[model samples]
Target chain A: MNETADTMNVPRSRAWTLFGVFAFVALIAAQVHAVLTSPADRDMGHLQKILYVHVPAAWIMSLAFLVVFVFSIRYMWRGQEKDDLLAAAAAEVGATFNGLTLVLGMIWGKPAWGAWWVWDPRVTTTLVLFMIFVGYLALRSFVDDPERRAQWSAAVGAFGAINVPIVYMSVRWWRTLHQIQSSPSTMDSAYVLGLRTNAIAFMLIMIYFIRRRYELARLRRATELIADAAALGGT
Target chain B: MNAESSLAVDAQRIARRFGARWCLRGVSLQVRPGEVVGLAGANGSGKTTFLRVLSTLLKPNAGAARVYGHDVTRAADDVRRHVGFLAHTAGLYDDLTALENLRFAAEMLGRSPEGLEASLDRVGLARVANDRVRGFSAGMQRRLALARLMLMHPRLLLLDEPYANLDAAGIDIMNAVITEVRNAGGAALLVLHELAPAAGMLDRVLTLVDGRIAAEGDGPAANAPTASAPTLASAAGAR
Candidate 1:
């Protein structure tokens, strides 16, 4: 019962330090292994190397959104402030990765598709998903009431998550310019190992970023509670 | 503990801090069923903060507070179920009509809106029951909030400056409702700047200075024009 107050009081700086070292080492190693071992495609050549960053970024973005959706549902159902904190943290990180994915895709497209932008279904839907969560973050900033903010943002977060699946399946559903989903079974073995290693690296960094963001949010909430207490003059 | 002995509010050695300064320090009080306690304090003195902590809107940094035996920190939902909080804001939707606001409160509390009209009439806002709150005057909006509180029938009422923006008739209505709640065996902790008008309604009055209780006495002494009284300062100093 007494544990609720400090439930989010994890050793934040130490964990972040460990994650920073591990992520940097793992990412450098994975990128090196991926570039050196995977042979360039016959048609796309070096342009295919962009897949290691772009595809893994998209995966991490989707994973972050998934965390937002689950945490948002938990927040609404249980009305725990910590759950809302996690949801907000995940949304911010997810939006960053979502933007990164879009930019990387655009960069990859300039070389492979001969253009910087396209109105492909996958690309368009991912843009829309990004906007929804961005709007969620905006709403949190505008609302003053903690409970109201949590309720409204959780609803938006959950709705934004619905678009994630649509974005993932857009290529298959509408026959857009974007290619269909890839899997290790269908890909060349050389590319598969590198892609898998990079995916792990990206996942580690995403988790680290979300945890650090969550810690920052917890500190902010604590400060706000203190200010409220001070203003009211209650013990 | 037996059901009858359960205090409506029980706070012990509660302390709250904002950065380096403390808002409430070692402040403690309790209210039994049928008790109406009026808390008097100057601006920025922490009356509202204390009510907020009791209502479970803010958690204390140290010590504990319970509403009807439910811990404010651990069982906030349980505490909220039995508590009605009238904050500095009316907490009403501007777009919703007075009746709609009461209905929304009822829906949120999972209670039936059986006496919605009666509640409105009690607060003297029945004529404007269907009018949007955005269009209502501050006193009328406060009346609408009071109606919502009456409809909710909470066991513990935490009212922060309930008389703000109220006219004479509105104040009368507010006083009548507070009296009615006490007569029905519920408890209320009212935080107010002026105690003269509410003196008759309160069973006890506590004067807060710099976050701690400076003076405490029965109703009449609280109503005595002590705005600049040396006794209060001396009491605060003696502490």
Candidate 2:
């Protein structure tokens, strides 16, 4: 690690690293167990196995967006720098998972739906949600002042979060090619354990990603503040 | 004692830090109404940070500041109403016309954004009132920022590098606004690297070195500050 990051003495804890390791191991274990235990689907054979990663990733992505929504609201309500930083971190992480979810969904769609993509309400809304957050990240980079960036981002974040529920409900609200949702209750007894375990693993990984990303954002902000002070001759 | 309570600014040992670096160590100062104080220092001396603390852009970490009797931290909104702070950047929207910019400020301040043409005329930007700030020259942009202060009716003006891109006429317009604020029982704090351009308009010069006031000197006339250049230069250079 660069010695300068230690200037503020904000130590990065070992717990996050340990948690990160556990999460990845658990994810791999879940994938391996699901591939072995679950028999081929009646309609789709082994192709239904994509549901393990796709469903869990989609769930985790939605959770990340919800985190963005909560933190953005907190930032606007309290005007704390931490809230803004957390919101920004979750937004970046959410955008990453959103891209992942879309890709995974397409991979499943190509084989299962026999199309690479469809104008499905669920898919379209998720794409729109992804675009809004990309624009949110772009706005953050474009604005130079920290305060302005936080304010504009908080507003955009709050508005962008409105799309999450829309994305979630798109299938039921409109007759879409995308399935409504998959859960332990609706899935077969054999697949429920895999789906539940995969969701749990995905949640753990997301927590690790968001927490580590937030730590980096805090360090980056500290560096910028220190640089401003250094430029002005303060030590 | 009553008069002291009425001072436009009263800051006591204000301290603020960024990360592990202390930008302002412990700075204390007072500015009476009808005064313009020039804050001069070399880069990194905390002159700009001091201004930021007072303007409520950044809060003090270990001390206190009050603008016109309102605590900077606890009553930041109240302090903001009395302060017209021109930060390092002009903080103007590029897409908005000069007139529209002033109108936005007015509306933000809860005014109706009417009678704004005269603000443009005051800054000699009347001809380009409808032109977007993106197309305006640096000097013109500075003038538009000044027009915003004029509209706000601030009791304390905090300006950082007010003369960087200004021409002679822009300089005069800025000084006139500062003078207007002083004459109306308000005060102004100016952070300037080069003192000569605004020297004649300042009432006192405070040289901040290493995050503290190192020297102070009186201005030219009843309220002019030209005579303080040497104090500022000597005090800043001594560091």
Best by lDDT: 2
lDDT (tens digit, per residue) of candidate 1 on A28-142: 9999998887787777777678889998998998899899999999988988888998999998999999999999989987877777776666676778888987899999999
**What docking grade applies to model 2?**
incorrect
Cα deviation of A212, candidate 1, in Å:
5.0
Q: Retained native contacts per candidate, as fractions?
A: 0.23, 0.00
Interface RMSD (Å), each candidate?
7.4, 8.6
RMSD for each model, in Å, please?
Answer: 6.0, 6.6
List, in order, the clash count of every candidate structure.
5, 3
Query: Residue by residue across A1-235, what tens digits does model 2's lDDT show?
Result: 1123345324778987899999999999999998899998777788879889988887887888899899999988988878888888888888998898899989988877778787666677778888988999999999866667888999999988876676668654665455543322246788889999999999998999888888888788677656644544432
Look at candidate 1 and give me any clashing residue pairs. A232-B46, A232-B49, A233-B46, A235-B15, A235-B16
**In candidate 2 chain B, what residue range of length 10 has the lowest lDDT sum?**
B221-230
CA shift of B58, model 1, Å: 6.0
lDDT of 2: 0.81
Candidate 2 reaches a DockQ of 0.06
List, residue by residue over B1-239, the lDDT tens digit for candidate 1: 76633999888867766555667876789899899998877776778889989988787866788888888998999998888888888889999988999999889878887888888888888888898899998888888888887766788888988888898899999888888888888899998766655757888888878878878888766667765355445333211
Q: What is the lDDT of candidate 1?
A: 0.80
Q: Candidate 2 vs. truth: CA RMSD? A: 6.6
